[model samples]
Target: MKETSEKKAIIKKLMKEGKTYKQISEETGIHPGTVGIYGGKLKKAEREKKCFNGDRHLCKTCKYRASGARSGCDYIIHTGNERGCNPEVCNKYERGNRNETKTSSKGK
Candidate 1:
């Protein structure tokens, strides 16, 4: 795996600056749950590299990949609507939703 020192540094800096995960996520365009996951805030049951499965096709059926929505897709959230997830490079890709209903775009 490639080193994520830069992203880790940013997360640590944001936390040091007293920025909440929501703030960091908005600033970096990373999904908030990912922020929590990497920051050691949210504990996951079966953790793996988000995109290690190597199947962009899976995104079509992913709960996180909502279609025609105004916002909230992982791809749209990070790289805007112009691009779709590149399974080869997207370590942050996820195939499912968090284990709860989200009332807003911001993650818990």
Candidate 2:
């Protein structure tokens, strides 16, 4: 209802301000879990946003491109235990086909 909307707005702002889940909860009177949930959504949005901030390569080439999703980069997603990397200035770029093993092994 209206109360939920108000809480959502506060959550959005706090998230944009980079407030921690516990901090947002204390300031907004929302539960820490709820703050974390909303914060996660907001953070995902900001991370996957296409940027013109000196990108050296397309996100598609980076392993953190979230290619498994149907919409490609609609939301930043994590693969395995690895956190998502920035498309604009990520120095730890890995290939998308990292899981594919070599089929031939010097059997000529």
RMSD of each: 17.1, 9.1
- Model 1 / residue 106 / CA error / Å: 57
Tens-digit lDDT track for model 2 on 38-108?
Answer: 77776666655655323345555654454343433322234334335444655555666523322345767
TM-score of candidate 2 versus the correct structure, residues matched by position: 0.46
Give stretches of model 1 more than 4 Å off.
1-3, 41-108
- Which stretches in model 2 have alpha-carbon errors above 4 Å? 1-3, 51-103, 106-108
Q: Taking the tens digit of each residue's C-alpha lDDT, what string does model 1 give over 1-108?
A: 324676777877897788988999999977788788777732221223444544455555555555465433455444445444354344444556633223466765
The global Cα lDDT (0 to 1) of model 1 is 0.59
User: What value of lDDT does candidate 2 attain over all alpha carbons?
Assistant: 0.60
Clashes of 1: 0
Q: Could you tally the backbone clashes for each prediction?
A: 0, 0
Worst 10 residues of 1 by lDDT: 41-50
